[model samples]
Target: MGQQGRSRTNGQGGPGAVDGFFEYARERQLIKLRRDAGESPPFTGDPVLRAYRFCNVFREDDRTTAWFRQNVRDVLRESPTEVTLATITFRWFNRIEVGEQILDILLEDGWNAKRIRSRLRNVQPLVTGAYMVKTPPGMSKLEGIIWCMKHINRRSLPQMPMTSLELAHQWLTQYPYLGDFMAYEVITDLRHTFQLQDATDIMTWANPGPGAARGCEWITGHKYNRHSKTDRVAMMNVMRELLRLANSDEAFLWPEDWPRWEMREVEHTLCEYDKYMRAVNGQSLKRRFDASHQGEERT
Candidate 1:
């Protein structure tokens, strides 16, 4: 047997091995179901592959970010109005096509909600239908843009500092409709524009979204408590330990082509796993993973 077959029943496993094993099995089951139904598999043939061509679908690569920064430099370099517009476009729709269309309309209609609403009325149904399940009280997407404008224009509110993710996200959350997830998105975008010192370090402080919470619960066999900071820390500890073992043990080795995962990347992977589980099994744990989190943005 190769390392994988030998390690499967060795009575020893790395921290992430259990999760990986389950995921591998689940993927195999999915493939079998698809074949039985006369449908194609969602990804490649290998159930155990950690990284694939589709890995970049959810996560941003360095090249993608760099290209994004260059293209938006003009908008980011100008007045805070432009920054507000760009951030709102991203937060509200998040989809590039929808966001770009609304942004173009905003430029033509001016920053206020009333004008944008009037101009976008034709496509309002489609746009509004695409919004997540819950929204800020009495706040539409157009209103969200205006709210961001007001916050950005406020002289009393300090500019988002590069090093302080907490302070930046806190300020963003004070605005209506800008929850933790949206705040993190805005701060991440602004960080690209700021070009400030320690910008790369801010991701380490990022709050995991609802999907990530669910993923963590599933991966840890429903043992991780999302509400407890101690449990969150424990999850990170487990990931780190698993990574260490994967590096040393051939049986636990991840995809050779894949780069080392940062903690934030691991969190991202958990979120993707959550989506995958929902599609494949729809078998959610009895405990509520989302109860402890605030400012959730679910799709």
Candidate 2:
């Protein structure tokens, strides 16, 4: 037997071995799925892989600050460790909240529209530095991008193009979350609507959700998943902004190739999707939705 096989047989690998094996199996399955789907593999580079590893590490030991220090802080070149540490420690805001705070700060600092555009690059680092230590599993790199864009849109900062609601709808479709409502709202409030062609492109790029939709349908006279034409347009705009943000070079530290590679690989695994749907349908609606959405996106 190979070392891995022997280790598993001897029970010497323990949970770590089992976990690694499962991960390997999952990747293999993903590759097969991509091949079957006739698609290229998704990208997996420094930032994307590192972010995934960091999230895994965080999940394994939520209490440990070492993960942040080792994974994120150590990656910085010229920044002082103390400064990085302080930045991580002092941050009290969630990803979106922090973006809002930064927008306020920039405005307060007399950053003009041009300066805001230039300084937009600084938002990622600032938010990353702040939330690196206590990163949540539900908050993805894409979410961070959306949050940053929302901040810019919310502030109506100069030079920032007006994003529409239809775009937001598309982005939220890919990565649904409770916080996305605010983003949707902002897009709806803005003018200069996107063309339907642009909206579809944004939808394709934004990768919106297949999960249960949530928002102001509660007290406000609106219904979830029952968006009006105006609402749909607004959502599309928001989604477009999210796509733009996500596709930006600074969106992630990982080599841009990683997600594309993984996405491509995952697409071929229709059997896996079928299996997941059959096995976990009753127990996990979210999983089912995710699998279905991924499958659709792959095609």
**Most TM-score-accurate candidate:** 1
Residues 182-235 of candidate 1: C-alpha lDDT, one tens digit per residue: 676566666545432245554345566666666666555556665689976776
State candidate 2's TM-score: 0.21
* Candidate 2 Cα deviation (angstroms), residue 242: 2.4
For all predicted structures, in order, the TM-scores are: 0.60, 0.21
Best by lDDT: 1
Cα RMSD (Å) per model? 8.7, 20.3
Show the lowest summed lDDT stretch of 10 residues, model 1.
290-299
